[model samples]
Target: MSVEEEDCPPLLETCAGERGNEDDDSDGWDEMEVSGEQTTCLFCPLQFHTIAVALDHCRSDHNFDLLSLKAKYDMDCYSYIKMINYIRLQKPHPKILTESSVALWEDDVYLKPGDMETWLMYDFDDLGSAPSTPHYAIDGKAPISNLSFSDLQRQIQELTIQLKHKDMLLENCHKDMEHMRKVTKTIVDSGDSLNKKIPNNVISSGCDSSDYFNSYSHFGIHHDMLNDAVRTEGYRDAIYKNIKMFAGKIVLDVGCGTGILSMFSARAGAEKVIGVDQSEVLYKAMDIIRENNLQDKIHLIKGQLERVNLPEDKVDIIISEWMGYFLLFEGMLDSVIHARDTFLKPDGLILPNRCNISIVGVDDIDRYNKVVNFWDDVYGFSMKCMKSEVLREAFVEIVPPEKVITNSVILTEIDIRTCDVNACIFSSTFTLSAHKDGMLTAIAGYFDTFFDLETEVRFSTGPHATRTHWQQTLFYLPDTIVVKKGDRLEGTVSCTRLTKNVRGLSVTITIGKNKYHYSLD
Candidate 1:
C-alpha cells in the first residue's frame, strides 16, 4: 500500500506527552509561515510538501524513527540543531544513524546550521527530557515576549532547571562542610594515637589532606583528567580491547570519577558495573550515565569503598585509575585494596595490574635556576631563606628526555592484585649509572601501567612518552654534583606517609654522606 497524507500524522502527535495547548492551533498557528516550503527527507533526497510528510516518509521508507532516537539519547535543543546540521552536512545512511553513538554529534562545530532548517522549529521541547533554552535564545536573538507559546514554556523550564542546579550545588556545599568537620574532629581526636604510629624521622609539613576528596567536587579537575588522552584512552583500551575478560563479568570501579570507566565496562558487554566515589561529583556522574542511557548496566554509590555496600556480593573485576603523582601520593590505592579484599572474587582481576615507578637523574640547570635560584634574589633583595622550603616540595613538571644524565632505575613495581597497602610506603635501594658527563641537579620520577590482558594495554607518563596529567615528579637536590660518564650514584629512597596527612608522602633520599627530604603533597 502506498503511504498517503492521512497515513502519516502530524509530527506533534508522535511526541508522546509533549504537545502544547490545543487552543494554540487556532491562535495564529500559521504565523511562522512554515507552509509552501518543500522539506527534504532526512536520510534521502526525496522532497515532500511538508516536514510531517518528509518525517513520515523517513519512518516508512528508511525505518528511521526520529522520536525514538531523540528519546533514546535525550538530546536537548542544541543537540537537535547539531544533529540536523550533521545530517545536512554528512548525509549519513539511516543504518549509521541507528548504530552510531550519540557522541558523533557532540562537536560544537555542528551547532551551526549548514542551511535553513525550518522543521527543527517544531516540537522542540519534546526532543529532550530536561528543560533547556533553545540555541537561538542562547544567542540573545529570541526574547520571552516575542517567543511562541512553546518557546515561552521552554524559557520557564530553563529557569526551573537553573534553580534546581543551583539548589543541588548549595546542598553539595553543605554536605562538604559537614564532611570536613567530621574529618577534622577525627584527626584531632586521634592525634596522640596517630603520632605514636608514625616513624620518628618522618616530618609532616604541608596542607592537610582534609579536602582531598572534596577537591574533586568541582568540574575543573575532572575536566583535566578527561582531556588527558593518554590517561583516558589507556583505560578505555584496557577495558574495551579485552572484551572476553569483561564480557558477562561484574565489575567494580573504585574512585569512579564521572563514571567513565564504569560506562566503558557496561558498553563492553559487562553484566553489571558499579562505581563507588566519595566526592560530590558522583551526582554529576549519575546524570552523565543517565544522559548516555547507560544507567541500567552501571550503578553508582557516593561513599567510600570501605563504608559502602555493593548491590552485588562479589565482582569479577575491579578497575580504578587510582594512581597519583609518583604512582601513590593520593593514597587512593588503600581504598582499592580494601575493595579488593572485601568485594573482589577469588579469581577477579584488576585493570592495570602492574605499575612500575622509575627514577632518573637529570642535568637541567635552567630548571634548577628558575625553580630554586629564583628565590635567592627576589627583586634585588636577599630571599635565600625561602629556598629551603622550595627545595622540600617535589615539583610536578615535564622534564625533557634530553636532560637525563643517568640511566633510569626502577624504584618500585606494584602488583595491585597482590600488593598490600603497606607496599606503597617502603625503602628501595637503586643505582643509577651516568650515561653522560653532566651535573646531576635533580631526580625525576615517572610511572607506567600495564593491564596484563591478551593484548597488554599500557602507557608511560615518562619524559619520552606523550605527557599525561601526572607528568613527572621532580625532587631537586640541595646542591649539584658533577660526575664523569659511567659514574654510579647509589642511593636509598624511602617513602613515608605524613603523620598529619596520611594521603601525602614524605620522601627521603640518602646518598653516601648527604641526605635530602621532600614532600609530595
Candidate 2:
C-alpha cells in the first residue's frame, strides 16, 4: 500500500502481521470511513480518527497549535508512565498489564545500559531515550513507586534557590571590599602613622644627647666610645684574644648596623665574614670597607636578619648586637633566634654566648610625689569643660622613675649558642609596689653580656661612659600617681615572638597597695 493510503493498517498490525488479527473483528464489517472519526487539523489538511493523532500530525508537518499539543500530549508523558509502572512493579512477581491499567518505566537517564559507559567517562546524562526503570517519585512524595514530573520540578526549584544564595554571598563580598578600601585610604592619609616613610636624615642622626641622658645613661657606653676604649692597649689586647678564638672560620654579624663587628671578624682573620642589617648604614660601611681595602674579605646584605636568605648550617659563628633599651623593650632578640636556627652550624659559636637580666628595688621618693600632686590639681577641675586641654598637656611632663612602684621579674635568660631562635617565645609576670611615699621618675634597667670564657661587657650607671648613639628609650607612662610607703601594685608581662628579630611585649599594671587596682588595657 502507498504511504498516504487511507486504508493502511494500524502500526501494530503492520508490524506484527497476522498475530495482530485478534482485535480486527471488533472494528470490521465496513470498508467506508467512519463519519465521527473525520476530524480535520486546523494547522494542516490532515484528517484522523483521534484528536491526539491529528494534533501530532499538525505539529510535525505544519508547526501548528503548539499550545494545544503541549497541553494534551507533552505533560511529562514518560515521567507519568514510569511512575505508574513503578507502583505496579512494587507488588513483585510476574508482572502483567491489564486492559485498563498503565505502566511507568523510569531509570537514571545517565546510567541506562547504552549510556552507562559514556556517563562513567564524561559524567553527563543522556536525554535521547525514555528510561526503562523507575528512579524517582511522581507527585511531591518519596518513591513508593518511581520517577515523576513533580520530582523534576522540585529539582529545578532547589537549583534556583542555590543560585539566589550564591548571588547574596557575592554581594556581601563586594561590600566588604569597599569598606576595606575606605579604611586603607583613611590610614594612608593619617600624617603621623608609622606605616608612612620616615625621613632619611632623621634615621641617620641616631639618638640625641637628651634621649641618651634621659634613658640610656645607666646601661652602657656608646658604640663610638666603646671603639675608642677598645683602641687602648688593655682593651685591644682583650678584644684581639677574643677574635683569635674564631680565626679562619666563617662568621656572621647580625644587625651589623655599621658593619663594625663584621670588620672585627675580618681583622681577626676569619675566612669569610657576612653582615646584614635593615638600616642604610650599610652604605657607610661599604665606604669604610673600600677605604680600608677590606672589601675582598667581607660581604654585606641589606635586609632584616629574619629575611636574610642564606644556606642552612653555613656559618661557623653568629654575632649580633640586638639588645634593646630596658633589655626587652623592642624585642629584637627574636630575630637573633631566627638567625641562630636557620644559618648556624650545629656546633657553631655565638658571640656573647649568654645574657643575664636582673631586677632590683631602688629609692626615688621625691620624684613620685611631684607627679601625683600635679595630676590631682588637674582632676579637681570640672572635667566636662577641660577634658581636651588636660589630654593635650598630659604627655609634656616627665616624672622620676623611683617614685613608681616596681616588682620586677626576670623575663628570660637566652643562650644564643644553643637557643633555637625560631621557636623561642618570651613571657613573664611582675608586680609593682610602693616602698616609700614618692613621685615616680623612671624604670632603671640594664643588660650584661658574657662574650666568652673570661672577657665580658657591661653597661653601668655612670658619666663619661663610651656612648654609641643607640641609647635606651624610655616608655613614659601616661599618668603618674602618688603612693605612700608599703602600697602594693601587681600585674603581668606578656610577650609574643613576632618575626626573626622582633618581639611584642605588653605590661599590665594594677595600682593601690591594698584593694585599689587599675589596668592599662
Candidate 3:
C-alpha cells in the first residue's frame, strides 16, 4: 500500500484547464462522472476529478514512471494491460501488479492481443465473489472485491455457471475412484489363496500388464491397422515368396489380428496353418476363413499364444506381424519369442529373421511451430504452460525424410531369428554430420525389417520409405542447437523396455549438455 498526501503537487490553473475532460477522453480514460465544480481529486488528493487532469499532475509533478510499472510485472504484452488507465482520478498505484491482474476488455468482452485494435477499455471491479483461485481448492472461497454495482451483478451470473461445472467434474472423479477400489480388492483377495492365477504362468510372469493391448480389440482399431498396405503387404510378400518353404509345411501365425498371414501361407500350399489372437476380433477371423473356404487348411486359436494349446505338436514355420513403434514398443515380441521356443520345430524359421534400427537428426521446423512455439502467444496470453508440457512428452507420427537435417546412423541390428526378447533394449552412439545449415530440433527413430535371406524381401518404416503403420518416433530436444552444414553432432540414444508396463518404453537422448527423456504412453 504505497499511499501519500499531496504526493502530486498542484498544477497551474490554465495548464490544468487546457488538459481537461476532452483530453481525458482522448487519452483512453473512462472514469466516474463528476461536476466541473467538483475539481478536487475524487479518489486521492491532487487537483481535479477528470482523469486527464489528474494524470497530468502525476506525470509532470509526481514522477510516476510507466516503464517501471511494466518492469515490475515482467510484462511483455504492454498493450493488453492498462493498469493506470483503469484508475479513476488517481495517481498510478505502486503495487498494481502485486494487487491485481490486468486483462484487456471491450464492451463487456475480454480481448486478447492481436485481436481488434480498438475497444481498449478497462474494468477493475470483481466481487460477486468466487475466490480468484480454483473454487475446488478449499471449502470456503470468496470472490475478490472492487466492482461497480452493475459489474457485481454481472459477475455473480458468471460464478453460478462455473460452480455447476466444478460439481460435475467432482462427481465423475468419485465414480472412477470407486471402480478402481473394487479392482484392487479383487486382486488382493486372489493373492491370499496363493493359487496359480491362470493356466499359463509364463505370460502372467513375463507381462507387466495386458490392459494396453486390450484396447486394440475395441472399435475398428485392429481392423484399420490391418488395412494399412505398408504393413499387410510386407507380410503378404514374405509368406507368398517363400512358398517353397511353406509347401507341405505346418505354419503358425502368432498374435494374428485377422489371419491374413495364415491365409497367405495356406494359399501358398502349407499343409496346415495355426492363427492365434487374444482379441475379440478373432471371431471375425473365423468368418474370413470360412468365406475364403480355407477352413480345411487354416485353424484359428482364440487365446494368447503362451496360454493356448496348439493342435499340432510342432510347426515348420512361424510368421507374425508383431512389430510396434520403434520395432518393439507394444511388447508383443515377447509372446512371439515364447511361441517360438515352446512350439517351433528345431528347424523352424521366423518370417522377419533380421531387423535394423536407425536414428537421425531432424530439423522439423513445422512440427515445432505447431506443437511448441504456437503456445508462445495463444490469443495474446502467454500460454507457456502448454509449451512446457509438450517439451516433456514424446511424439509418435510419420516423419518425412525431408525433415531429416543430417545423415542417419544405425543404432543396432537385430536378428529376430536368433534375438531373444530381452535383447530388444539397446543403445548406440551416433555422429550426425549436418546435411545443411539448420537448427537441429529433435532426433527420430526408424527400423527396417528383413523377411528372408534367399530373395532379400524387406521394407523400412524409415522416413525415406513409404508410410507404414509403425510410424517413426520423435524425441524433441529440450532446446534447439544450431549447426553449420558440415558440423558434426555427436550424441547417444538409449532405449529401454519399461518392465513396470511392458507396452510402455523410455528413450533417453543426450547432445552436448542437454538431455531429454521421453516415453511411449
Candidate 4:
C-alpha cells in the first residue's frame, strides 16, 4: 500500500524513511489534536491515507458473514453489538429503529445501508442520540501512537495467511461428512434390495398353513399325548436313570412341546438345554419353564429345528418325543433326524435309540362288522355304495389282546441316530400262523421304543400291552380270509406318506395275489 506525499493529511506524517535528502518534517503533525476518527482505524491501530481506504480495509479484513460468523464462533447478540461499536467507534446505540427508509443513509443521522449486511442482525441502540445528527469524521482523524503502528503491515499479512489455512481445513471436514452420509445411505439401500430379491415360495415356507403346521400347532390336541403315562413315563425314567449322559452336557430338544423333555434334561444336571418348536404351542411351553423354575437352565425357542439357530454349535444329547400315530404317520422323525445331522456332536447320543414297528394278524370280527357293515345298509335300505369308500381307509382304534389272532412280528426296526425321512417309506414282509381258525379281519400295527440305557428300558403301544394314545392302526382286508389251524398267512405291507396330506399315511397290502390300498387321513 503506497501513499503519495502530496495527498497525506497534515496531522499524520507520510513515510520518507529512505529519501535521505528529504527534510525530516514534523511541522504541524505532532501537536495536532486528533479527532480519533479517519487516518487510523478506530478498532485497530492500523493507519490509512483516506476515509475510503480505511473503510475498504475494514470490509476486506475485519467484516464477517453475520450468520456464518455467529454459528462458527458461537457468538451472541451482545458480541455482535460490541463488534459493530468497535467497527464504527460511535457511542453504543441502546434503542432500535423499526422502519427502513431511502433517506436514512443520505441523512447525517442514520447508519448507511452499505454496512447493513453485517449490522442488520445486531440490535442497534440509540442511546438518545438524534437521527438528524449522526457521527462521522469531519476534519480530525482517530489518533494512534506511532510505536503501535510501526509493524501494522506485518500483523495484517500474518492474520490473512492464517484465515486462508483455516478455510482449507473447514472445507475438507465438510467433504468427509458428506462422504460418510452417502456410504450409510448405500448400505441401507442394499439391505432393502436383498429383502425384495427373496422368492415368494421361500417366504411362504416359513409360515404354517393347513398342509403341515396347523394340526401340530394346536397344543390342546397333544395335551393328552403329553400326559399319557405309557408314553411320557418311559422318557422320564430313561432320562433320570442316565444322569452321566446329561450331567454337565449341552442338550437339544427337537419339537419340544410344553418343554417337558427339556425340564427333564435340566433336572438331570445338563449344563445348557435348548428346546425348539415351530408351533404356536411354544408360548404354552414357555409357561412350563416358568412354572417349574427351570428358566435359568433351559431356554425355549419358538421356531423349527430345521431353520432355527441354536445357542450351541454342537450338542452332547438330543432328546425329543417325536412319535406320531402308527409311529411315522406325522413324519416327526424327519425333524429329529435333521437335528441329528445338523447339530449333534460326534459322540452325542439320541434318545430312544431304536424303534420297532410291530404288525399282527387280528380277528376283530366285532370291530370289523361295526365299521364296514354299518355303511352297507341305511335304515334297512340298500346303501352299499358307501361301503367301498369306507374300505379305502384304515381305522385307528384300540384292539383287545383276544382280538389278536397271531403272535406279533417285527415289521421294521429303526435306529433313531441313523434314520432319515425316507426311512418311513418302507416295505416289510410278514408271516403269521393261526393257532385257532376263525376269520382274519384286519392287519394290526403298533410300535415299541427303546433307549440304549443300561437296563434296556422299553415302552410299547400294542394290543398285547397297556393302551396308549396311538391305540393301534388296523388295515382291514376287503374280503375276509379264512385260515385253518397252523396255516400261515404271508404278505408284504408297504407304508408310505401320502402325497396329498403330508401328515397322513397310506398302506398297500399284498397277500395271496390280493392287493389292497388304504389311506389314513
lDDT of 3 by residue, 1-521 (tens): 11331242232222123334543434312222211332333235654533334435655554543344445445343332333333221122333223322221111111212211111212212111253222111222112232244544544455566777789878977876786689678877766455724322112112122475577667477666777887788888877776687899999988777778889999999999888887766777777888999888888877667776788999998888888888878757888788878988898898887788898888988888888888889889989877767876778897777888999899888877776765555556788999899989888898998887466688988899888777888888768889889999877776654434556676667776565767776
Each prediction's TM-score versus the true structure: 0.60, 0.44, 0.59, 0.60
**Candidate 1 lDDT tens digits, 411-521:** 889999998766655667789999899999999999999989897899999988998999999999999999899999988787656544668877888776787888887
lDDT of 2: 0.46
lDDT measured at residue 505 in model 2 versus the true structure, 0 to 100: 27
Question: Model 4, 1-521: lDDT tens per residue?
Answer: 13565666432353322233345564333433433433554346688645445545655665623334445445454554544543352221111111111001111122222222212221323322254211223444323342234434544455577787789989977877787689678867876676645322111114222346556677666787876889888999999888777889999888787788999889999999988877667777777788888878888776567777777899999988888778888757888998999999889989988998988888977888888877777788977788888888888889888888887889889999886666665677778888788799998889999998775678999998887888898888889888778889887777655544656777777887787878877
Count backbone clashes in candidate 2: 35
User: Model 3 shows how many backbone clashes?
Assistant: 4
Q: Can you list the residue pairs that collide in candidate 1?
A: none
Which candidate leads the pack in lDDT? 1
lDDT of 2 by residue, 1-521 (tens): 33533564463233222332534554422222111324454434456644445546755676544334224333254443332333232221112111111121223221121211101111012222353221211221223122234533554465577788789989977877787689688878978787565322112222112231233233234344345442222223434677666688888887666666777778888888877766655666667777887777777766566555653348988877676544454535667777777788888877667765533233444543343334545556633443323322212122234323555445457676666542223334345566667644433333445565455544421112333232322223335455567765453332222221233322222223311111111
In Å, residue 242's CA in model 4 sits off its true spot by 1.0
Which runs in model 3 stand beyond 4 Å of their true positions? Answer: 1-209
- For residue 485, model 2's alpha carbon misses the true position, in angstroms, by 7.9
lDDT-superior candidate, 3 or 4: 4
As for candidate 4, its clashing pairs are 36-142, 37-141, 37-142, 93-125, 93-126, 94-125, 94-126, 95-125, 95-126
Candidate 4, residue 76: the lDDT equals 51
User: Every model's Cα RMSD, please?
Assistant: 27.6, 28.2, 22.4, 37.0
